[model samples]
Target: MNFEYSDRSKALQEKLTAFMQEHIYPLERAYDDFVHANEWQVFPELERLKQLAKDAGLWNLFLPEEYGEFSEGLTNLEYAPLAAIMGKVYWASQVFNCSAPDTGNMEVLAKYGTPEQQDKWLKPLMNGEIRSGFMMTEPEVASSDATNIATSIVRDGDEYVINGRKWWTTGAMNPNTKVFIVMGKTDPNAARHVQQSMIIVPADAEGLKILRPLRVFGTHESPEGHAEIELDNVRVPASNLLVGEGAGFKIAQGRLGPGRIHHCMRLIGAAERALEMMCKRVTQRSTFGKDLSQYSSIRQEIAKSRCEIEQARLLTLAAADKIDRFGIKEAKDLIAMIKIVVPQMACTVVDRAIQIHGGLGVCQDTPLAMFWIYGRSIRIADGPDEVHMYQLGRNTIKSFN
Candidate 1:
């Protein structure tokens, strides 16, 4: 495989790296301070950074021409490194309108929405005029199996009435989140995977209530908020239904391929940052008349971290390449393999960084603990590692047979 990055990708990567250093990295502390000070509102500085990124033509790097509405239209392989750079700073992706839930939502609308639907939401979403959330996982079901979701979207004349309780609906708590792409059972009697449908529900509709934000690891409140909300007889135009009455599963499969790749790339960035911090800490601190780096165990940890990061990076790029070359369905095994590997890799790398720093690493003074939490969350978020591992293992066994 030709693993080398193209000139176009390299140029964009350099530009993105420079933007992160000059704009994003410097704002890390300030971003934390802003979040702490105004825990309820969106960070004003992030919006400003978004404008800067847009003006520089660095927006929506994840959406390729296959979608037709993406600005720069970079392929998954081309976008991987730039996304890796953004992953280094958790909040950086939003500046370029490349962050999650919205990215997945946009991909769905672009691929499935009717002309009128695109005009209403897709255009504004591409411009980053508003934010959105996906509501598929329900509080009452084993959500990893989408077929188990209990939400119902029943037709009522010109509109569909939706009812269900959903948690971990990431981004729903943000006031800026104007829409929700909800998944529910439209025809429970239909075949297992075909029973569900996705519909656009306006955030302001009556009977819709965003209850509270669920904390990740008892600390961080995802700015958009991993939220619990009630959609009690919420109503939307029947025209809001995407693709058809039983297309939610299909839409999810299409959206999640790119979404998983984005997550894996971001995890690599996080792991790289943790390794940087670990090395800096180990070398700068002296203990027992020598730098911590001189300790054999610490040196080994650093070396091992480097090896792990390189391996995970290569695997993530391979997954991206597979998605670009073959459709997501065709690359399911690789996608599952990377999904299982990257987050676990990041968690290990960040945990080591924390250990090297002693107390400071686990404290707010350093981002290591937060990085660790983000990595750990992904282990359960989206889906669990056990689930991916099971699928990957089964695929491997089948291939051998």
Candidate 2:
């Protein structure tokens, strides 16, 4: 199959790449300085970054054709490379309003929310005036199997009352996070897959509490931290229900296909950055009376990393191509395959980069430590590697059967 970037994609890629160099990279040092201070004070430069990306026509590139009202529209295949480019810097996606779980939440609103819901939530999100979080995981249940999500969305006259504790509610720490796409059981007795539903709850809704930001490795990722929360009878209008009751699973399936592809693509970018760092580092550093790059073992590691990164990129792009050509259901195998492969590949590449950097790699002097941890975290995020592998294996056997 043809893997060449289309003319449109090529032009956008050039523009986006230049924007990254001119606008985003300059803030890299400032970002590190803030992190070392132990609090992510709202970045004053953030609004400027957003404006620059928007003016350059690189905004909302993740909005697929199905969400045209929220975007002019680019298919998953066309957007994959741009996303990979953004993935090079951990915070670059926000500059273009393409970060998740906002992207995933916006897709749900565009595809499932009522007209009023879209006007209120989706519009602001698309316009970059607000941010959002997804509350699906629970501390008490195995959230990897979504059916175990125990938050209750009980109907009460003109509203739905939501009750449960949720952790990993991403973006909740951001003061601008104005809404949440919450998943909970609406009909516990319905067929297993259809028992749950999604509701859009205001961040300040009554009975909703942000318990704390959940740290990754040890850092709280301030300003846009992952949060643990309690929704004790939190209520929103019944109209906030997305698509009818018992449709959360269906919506999640549609949402996660795009999300997984984005994550894999970004992981590819992160791996690329790590490889770059490793190569540059080895050539400049000398050990045992010779250059590190001259060592056969270092050469082998570099070669191995290059091969794996290229392979992962192609696999990710292939998955994006499949999702665009076939529907998400038909592309599930490729989606699961890359979801499992990309992060592991990234983690290994970053780990080698870390080793190559010596003590500096494990410290704040470079981004290798953060990249290594993020790639490691991705193995457990979305769905764990084992979960996706199980699905892929079952699908393989079923196809043969």
Candidate 3:
């Protein structure tokens, strides 16, 4: 397949590159400091950057033509490289209103929301006026198998009351997160796939409580905090359900296909940045009066990293192309393949980059450690590698049958 960027994409790429250089890259340390000083609250600078991004016309690059009322209306193929640029600076995506949980949640609303639902949630989200979260993982279940989720959403009178605990609800810790697209079983007696449903719950509803923030790799908070939450009989009108009762699994299948590709694109970007840093570091510093870049091992790593990144980028683009040509369901194998490949590639590249930098790589002085964390986190975030591999294998075998 031809993966060439169109003139429109190229021009947008130029603008995005300039924007990152002029505004985002310079604020890396400032963003860190602001986050560290705040007591689990969003940094004020985020809003300021959001306004700048909105003014500069870089907002909502993830929204598709069908779903976007106030966005660039770019498809997954068009949006991949732009997302790659944002991945270089971890916080940059939020500035453009294209970050995760929000992106996934927005897509769900756009694809499945009623017109009224779109007006209430999608409009404010697209405008960057409100934030959202997705609560599906449970603290007790091996959440990799979403069917194992035990959260319950039961209808009572005209409303549904949700009861369960969710961890790794990524954006829930943010005080500004105004709503949650929560997944829970609405019909335990229905068929396995049809037992669940997705409901939009107001984050401030009486029974919704943010119990505490969950840490990753011993780090208590990553600038964007992941959280554990207790939804104790949270009530929302029956009209808040996305598709319909017993449609949760269907919605998740559709939502995760796009989300996985976005993660792959961003991971490829992270690997690209890590490789750039590796080459720069090894060339500038000499070990025992010889250039580090001159070493055969370093040269091998550099060559290998180049190949790996290119392969991962191609795989991601192919997945995007498949999604565009066929429906997301038809593109499942391509999506799963890239989801398994991209994160591992980024982690390996970042690890080598870290080795090249000596101790400095693991330190906060450079982004290698953070990049590594992001890639490593992906192994667990969107269903672990093993789970996706299992599905891919089963799908492959099914085709032969």
How far does residue 206 in candidate 2 sit from its true spot (Å)? 0.6
Q: After superposition, how far is residue 401 of candidate 1 from its true place, in Å?
A: 2.7
What lDDT is obtained when candidate 1 is compared to the true structure?
0.88
> Tens-digit lDDT track for model 1 on 1-401?
56799899999999999989899999887786777667757887877899999988899888975775454767788898888899988778889999988999999988889999989998888899999999988888999878899999999999999999999988887778899899999999999999999999988999999888888877545467788999999989899999899998999888888899898898899999999988888889998999999999998999999999999888888888887787788889888988898999999999999999999987777778778887998898888899889889888999999
TM-score of 1: 0.98
lDDT of 1 at 241: 95
Worst 10 residues of 2 by lDDT: 33-42
Mark the regions of model 2 whose C-alpha exceeds 4 Å error after superposition.
36-40
> lDDT scores for all predictions?
0.88, 0.90, 0.87
| Candidate 3 regions with alpha-carbon error over 4 angstroms | 68-71
Candidate closer to the true structure by TM-score (higher is better), 1 or 3: 1
Give candidate 3's root-mean-square deviation (CA, Å). Answer: 1.3
Q: Tens-digit lDDT track for model 2 on 121-177? A: 999999999999999999999999999999999999999999999999889988889
lDDT of 2: 0.90
Candidate maximizing lDDT: 2
